[model samples]
Every structure is written in structure tokens, then in C-alpha cells.
Target: MTDHLPRIVVGYDGSASAGAALDWAAEWAELQADEPHEVRAVIVGTAMDPVLGGYRARNDDLLERWRSEAEQRLAGTDTAPGQARERVEVRHGPVVPELLRAAEQAAMLVVGSDGHGLATGTLTGSVSQHVARHAGCPVVVVRPRRSTVANRIVVGIDESPEAGRALRFACRRAQRTGESVIAVHGCFSVLAHVLTFDGAESELAARSLAAGERLVQEVCAARAPDFPDVEIEPEAIPVRPGQVLVDASRAASLVVVGSRGRDAFAELLLGSVSQHVLHHAHCPVAIVR
Candidate 1:
């Protein structure tokens, strides 16, 4: 069953975005050749009931055709020869749930921004959103367009544990690809605005910026020893985290963000900043939970 290999699950539905996602996943698996990883391309379809007694065979044949097409598409993905270890899985059920189940044992779950039934220009499909928020492991949402910035990975930094996890994930990727890591920390102080009327706005703003810089440095310093080879560029911005990350995404190969932050409501599965970046980032987004 090759269960010993690290598994990566990708959703495929014969759409352009899905094809791009498959290619990304295959290439990612190939890059991990030294680590021995496997890519599982999962194609999900709803179960259909026969309309009549004689329609049973027709339904079965249609399902088989879909499976065959999925297999062919999986085989056509561009990957390093002898480096990609992949398999196609056809399941009868809803897409998001099937993929989530498959991700139970997978190292990562990947999907496209748009799919067969998903609308265009929406940034992210409904299925991708659901899975990214609820997947057991990290989720990578790949956009259709190929990324031009392949030399760097951008990750959001905060006080949450998930933020630390995201940083570690980005560092590991940077280590493997020889890419630089951009650690961005966004800080906005409500006290600075309130103190504006009291004539202390400038003083408070400066303090806020210094605090932001310290927080970023502290977080990165703790993990610096573990990823000594990864080049880290830390930026403390005075804007919303989502906007800063979205702007950074324009020149980033990948944007990694925590699913939830320290300020997020307990009941929310995804933080507002992460959600915003997932929908507006130019390149692929990875939600680390």
C-alpha cells in the first residue's frame, strides 16, 4: 500500500485549475525525492441512481469512463521522470468531505482555486475554502496561473501557535528549494488612534511599531537555529496583515498563513486575515492549522 511514504492528497475534477493543482502536487512530490513522498490524486463524483431497470449498466459505464479520464489526466501531469510516485483515486461522494477524509493520514491536502462547478474570479472555490478551514493537516490552494516568483516564500507571523507552525513549514520548504523566507508581521494599534485626540498619537505609534518589530524578531529568533540555512527577511508593517500579505503575494511563490490567530474567535475555524489572504493572494496559499 506504500503507506510508509509521506502522502499528499490533491483534488482533481478535469478542470484547468485542477490540472494546474495536479501539476503542482506532482512537482512537489518530485522535489521531495530525497524524502520519499507519494501524491494521491482524488477525483470525486456524486453517486447516481438508475432512472430505469435498464439504465443500471449505463450509469456504471459512465462512472468507469470518468475514472479512466482521471487516470489519464493524472498520468499526463508534468513531473521529474522517475521521481514522481502517484496514484489516482476515484470515489463516489461529495468532493470536500472525500478530500478531507483522504487528508486524515496525509502530510498535506492540495486543491485548486477554481474547479468544474466553481465560479471563476472568485479567487477560491467553495470546496477549497471548506477544506482549507477544516482539513486535519496543512492545505495548499493553487491558483491556475503559474507563479513567476519561485525564489521566495512569504509567511505571516503572530503570537499564535499556528503562526509558529506556519513559519516552520515555510522554513522547511525554503530549506528544500533554496528559497528565501520573508517573515511579515502586521501591527495596528487601536490605542494610537484613540490617543490622537489627546495629542499623544505620534508617541504611541512609535511604541507600537517598536513592539511589532520586537515580536517579529523574538518569534524568528526562537526558530533560527533549527533552519540555519534558510535566509530570513523579517518585515514589521503598520498595515492590516491580510493586505500586507496580499501585496507580498505578488512576488512570492507561496504565501503561508495560520488558520487562526490569537485574536480570532474561538468558534471560528479560520481567522479573518487568513481568509482574506486565501481569497486575494496572487500565488498559491498554504493554511497551516
Candidate 2:
């Protein structure tokens, strides 16, 4: 990789979701204006055990077949002329570690959701979740259904440095693509709503909503002047933040969220709302640390 070009690593498995991931990475790289970008498609598979010497030849054949398939898939994607340079890499090992290694020099790591969950049927696979949690750079998990409008980037915000990072990323992307930013803040207090009387519950709910609105406004205001041309839309909704963001993703070009939020436990790599959005959002999701 050249020092002037940022690299993007994508885990390609030839699955539908994986194909979408490849496409998203390519498009994202093309949108970068600071410098040229490169796309590396990594296909990871299990290594054949050396103990099975009798089957070594068979294993080698299987690996060759997998590599060929990956190359074909890489060639099938649409690449813009004179845009990001592309390459395909085949590795035999655990998926998470290989991807992490590949991402060491990458600007962002991208993977696709398997779309096999109960809520929205688009859940991050175990490998993707692991890499997203542990990668050195930001990670993007592209869902199966991407928005065609390409007009808005929705970001989930709270009082965390990770959220601030996400906001900055969204702003950069908006600057490149001319998309607006939707700063979303969701407010829900279980204790206040479930453990209090009617009047008290209403008052608590109102207070929570007001606080959410203020948080959104403050965060957006802090970043707005820097991105004068990028329209910032602040949304404070009286609902679960994850759900609200997921709903907003239906028409958004991309959904950005922090790896961990204010309520996340210290050991948790991803907060509950971020995880929820990763699984349910209809557009590409970016998890920023």
C-alpha cells in the first residue's frame, strides 16, 4: 500500500450480503477526496489440518477452488475508472484474526450482515461482530437492502467520545457526497416509565425527551459550523434510540453509530443500541470506535 492512499479491507465470502459489502466498500473508496484509496478483498477459510496427511491433496484442491471463486467475485463488481485500486487476498485461518490483521493498515474494515435474525432478518454474523469489536480502525457492516436515495447519513449520538468520532466521520462523508446528516437522539427511561405513577411517569418522560433534544442540539451545534454546507437535522424522539435510528435507516444512505455508548458496560465492545441497529437497520451501518 502507498503511504498516500488509504486502504479499505472487505471480508468477501461470495454470499449476497458479502457482495453488497464489496460494492459498498468500492463506492465508499471512490468517494474519498483527500487521497487515492485501495480496496483489498480478503477471503478467509479454515486451514486443512496437517495431521490429515492422506487428505492434504484434497484440501489443497478445495483451497484453490475457493480462491478462484473469490477472484471471480471480485472481478464482477463495478469499479470506477481511475478510482480506488483493487486486489483480492485468500487466507487460511480463523476469520476474525485474519481480518483484524488485514485491517491493521486499513482506514476502515467492512463486512456484510447475514440477514438471518428474527427482528429484521439482517444480523451481523459472528465473524463480522468479532472483527467490528476488535478491529484497529472503524468497521462498517453493510446490510442486504441499501437505500437508493443516497441523500442522508443518520448518526446515533450520546455523551461519548465514540459518538463524537462517529459524528466526525458522518460529516466527512457528507462533505464528500453532498448528503445531509440526521443527528438522532433516542430517550427512554424504564425506571421512570414503569415504576412511577401516571403524573410522575409523564413528567419523567417529558424530562427525558427534553434532555435528549438538548443533547442532540448541543452535539450538532458543536460540529455544524465546520460543515457549513452539510445540512444537519436534529431528531429527538421518545422511543428506543436503536429503534428510531433503525427506522431512519430505511431512507438513509448510511447509518453511523458508536462502538460503545454511555450505558454500555466497560467490558462490552458494543452497546446494546449499536448492536440493535447493526442487526435491524436497512442501510449500510458504520461502527466507529
Candidate 1 local lDDT, 64-176, one digit each (tens) = 66457656766776654554455778776666777889889799998988877322322238888889889999999996424684689999998899989999999998998
The top-ranked prediction according to lDDT is 1
> lDDT by residue for model 2 over 1-289, one digit each (tens)?
3445678888876567777888788878767655667788887656546666656676557556645765676566565554544477877776678789989968999998762211221224776677777888999998755568669999998888888889989999999899899999888777657856855557778888899999999999999988999998988987778889989999998999998888667336535787788778998889998
TM-score versus the correct structure, for each prediction = 0.87, 0.85
Report lDDT per candidate: 0.80, 0.78
Q: CA shift at 178, candidate 2, in angstroms?
A: 1.7
Candidate 2 — what's its lDDT?
0.78
Which residue ranges in model 1 land beyond 4 Å of their true spot? 50-66, 76-84, 117-124, 144-147, 193-201, 266-271
